[model samples]
Target: MRLSTVILPFRRWHDGGADQWRRAEELGFHTAYTYDHLSWRSFRDGPWFGAIPTLTAAAGITRKLRLGTLVTSPNFRHPVTLAKELITLDDVSGGRVTLGIGAGGTGFDATALRRPEEEAWTPRERADRFGEFVPLLDRLLSQDTVTYEGTFYSAGGAQNVPGCVQRPRIPFAVAATGPRGLRLAARHGQAWVTTGDPKLFETGTPQQSWEAIRAQTEKLAKACADVGREGDGPERILLTGFTPDRPLESFEAFVDFAGRHAELGFDELVLHAPIPDSPFAADQRVFERIATEGVAALGG
Candidate 1:
């Protein structure tokens, strides 16, 4: 299984941001991702680091680690502009970039964007709009002229000049939590990244949370099959957040749980360390353990 690391963009740890990325490469992480939020839900930090610039910085620092947004909100930027920026990053990274995106989720600074709370659509509506946006993005990234007409957005014969440096197309992933979103990921994304406290689901005690994730993965697989797309086949199921207090048993259960999903064809499993204010804090020890024993046990 391939493993990656997720980092928050807004913090002092990110101040030496490019150097931090180089450290992740040295730590043997295959990819490094950053969140694209103006402000986090529960904490305030230094000035928000815009996603594109930080990713570009990551590109300059790491030669092999794939760089990307953990999940950028579509509501925050126009699809055409995002496509261009992604292509530019891909070129700078020598085609080592993946675009992970989603409709805006909670803690989103809608007011900061000057979008009223009521104007924010329901998850269903956001999913519908995202459906329209993805195909347009795919076209634009592929250097095709976009002539799309949709309720949320419309464009007329706008050509995306200087296509992505990545051959064929840059890989696109989706961070999904709901059924509609999962279906969208199965159809549109090359991979899906799931975020949650895995301990809530991994303990053998039959919890609703664990059942929900299993059901969601089953539904996602079916959705892919319905659309004639491969679902969680290989390098598709990128599960994040599987940390526990103890290293051995916790890591064992974590690998066991992921292996169950792998039996169902779920592929990549990325364990995210808890976000910390400082990069070398106590929480980082968990990542160190995973980099050593946890990865070896899971065959990462």
Candidate 2:
């Protein structure tokens, strides 16, 4: 399976996120990413940079490593505008861009965007909005001129004259676990990303969590079949942010984790950011060790 790492855009990133991305690429990571939020819940009071500029800079600095937002949503930006931005990013990144999208939750981002209390989105409404958002982006990125008026958005003859560097569009890594969200991924995503059983990750053992995701991955295969997808549904991406507070049991867990994901048909694995400053001095030792030994063990 391919490997990616999400670099949190705090602490020593103000100068350049690219430096970290360069290191990730140098170490043989396939993709590099930043979290997409106006302001994330943890470190809300601390500094946080927008995902686009960070990714754009990452594109400028690196040639081999793919770049993307770990998850962007339609909370503050409309699909029409965001579509153009995404294409431009593809152009800047020379087509090595993947759109990792999700149904945005009610958190600091919603409040910072000034979403009205009366208009607060429930889980269903968030999913509904996301459902409209992805397909609209797909059309806007590929079609020369398009007019769309959905329940949540409208684009009046929007133009994408030259189109994207990637033919129809850049790859979309859609994040989902629910039926509706998974269906959307089956319809539009080149890659389907999941963190497994969302609540279970907080308390379950590593193996347990992996087992849960394996079941969900099987469910996704069924969803693909329902949509008449024959060969392969989409590239499966397992995001390793299930429990951010805890570190993996290092080499053994890392090797087994990547192996299981590959065996279960996952195409890529996205690692959560490790603590920049850890008592064991993890940032340097763990990642490099993973790159040299762990990934080798998994045949990455």
Candidate 3:
């Protein structure tokens, strides 16, 4: 099983991204990821950085820690431009990039471009849009040149110059909460991630969240089977923190949460690095403890 963490980019303004990710790699994290939002609601009032650029800079600093977005959606950018950026990131990282994506939320990300309210997307429309978007991205990355004309997006002679360092492109870590989204993950994901019931997190009950993950995994397994993929088709990634309601509050809680996810059939787990609010050394101490005593407690 693999273990990873999400570095909240807004929090890294003080320490800088390079130090944050390198610490994760040096501490034995398999992957390091950042939340991909144009403006996360919590930090909407203040400074925030772009997810792709933060990850690109992280790629330059770290050697082994696989880097990616927690979940990038087709809310603002076209698939063509995203494909080019992702492939270049793959090359720059020596193929250590994983593209985690999903059907976008209807928050600032959707309205950031100021599209018409009548054109505001329903859940079903978002699903349909996602279904179209992922396959096109798949084609854009794998093929040398792509010419696609779909209901949601179109591309003409879109060149994937030099292609990806990872043949057939970087692995996709697709996140899904609904059936339509689950099937998309089954169809194209190299790794699968879920945070369980978003509603359940409002109450911060770890047990309930774990149950949601278990149920989702069963459905995901069937999604794979329907498509003739094996039971363990994609690496299952579970996100535990990155939210105020549900966090790794204590060392014991962190170890317990991670182990149970492994028991529930998830192959990988992700936690949120503490927001840098306290003294710098104190904030880092939290990470150091998680990497050392916390990881050691997970058993080798």
Candidate 4:
């Protein structure tokens, strides 16, 4: 299985930020992704940079490291504008950009744009909007000119002149677990991502978390079948850290962690790059060792 890392956008490009991207490339990570949010939880008051710009900058600095968002959502984005930015980013990266996208959560981002008096989107509404969002995005990225009118978004002959460097736009790594979202992923995703089950994050054991991921992957397979997709559908990705597993505690630990998930049909595994003082905190040394040696340990 391929190993990757999620580098949070909490540092400025010039202020020791570029180093992380450079180091990720040096460490031989398959891809380096960042959270695409205006402001994420906990890091809300801290120095959080924009995803596209950070990725654009990383693309310039790193030659082989693939760059992308852990997820960009429709919560505060429109397909037309997002597609435009992604097109430019793909060109800048020389087609090494994967747009990890999702239906978005009801966290700070859900209400960041709305007034206190205005209510946030209900669960059903969010799902309904996402249903419109992904396909519209798929079209906007693939076609040169699109004029789409949907319930949550409308594109008025939006022009994407030369289109993306990756042929049919950049690859999309869709993060989803629900039925509609899974169906959307099955249809549109080049890769499907999961952080296991959020419900299992704080309360469930590691074995339970693995089982939850197994079930979700089965659901994704069923979704792909529903869409008439033959063979293994989208690439499976399991983003580590959120689940109650200490994958990065040691190199051996990561090997064990990766071995189990790889058996669950995951094509790639993503670890959060060490953050100094947070839930994602880990020994930087161990992390680097895992990046360099852990994957090979799982093999002969």
lDDT of 1 by residue, 1-300 (tens): 666777667645345656667877888877888777777664444456788888887888778898877777766767878887888899898999988888776555544665364666666777887877887787888856778777777777877667777866788788776766767777668787664445564563424445555666666677778777852431464545432222223556556666655554456656554555432133565565665565577555
lDDT of 3 by residue, 1-300 (tens): 677888867745446656788888888888898988988876777677899889888888888889999889988878999999999899889999999898888878888887476465788888889999999999999999999899999999999988999987889999997888888889899988887787775665666677777899999998999888875788898876522223355666667667777787788878677675521112556556777676568775
- Candidate 2 per-residue lDDT, tens place, 133-209, comes to 99998899889899988899999999987889998998899999889888888889999988778677557776777
The per-model lDDT (C-alpha) reads: 0.67, 0.79, 0.81, 0.92
lDDT of 4 by residue, 1-300 (tens): 899999998888888899999999999999999999989888888888899999999999999999999899989999999999999999999999999999888888899899999888988898899999999999999999999888779999999988999987788899999999999999999999999988988899999999999999999999999999888999999889889899988888888899999899899999999998898999999999999997789882
TM-score of each candidate? 0.83, 0.92, 0.91, 0.98
Candidate 3, run of 10 with poorest lDDT: 276-285
The parts of candidate 1 lying over 4 Å away from their true place are 12-14, 115-118, 177-179, 196-208, 230-234, 242-264, 273-282
Error of 2 at 249 (Å): 3.5
For model 3, what is the C-alpha lDDT against the true structure?
0.81
RMSD in Å for model 2: 2.4
Query: Using lDDT as the measure, which candidate wins?
Result: 4
- Summing lDDT over every window of 10 consecutive residues in candidate 4, give the lowest-scoring window: 291-300
Q: Is candidate 2 or candidate 3 better by lDDT?
A: 3
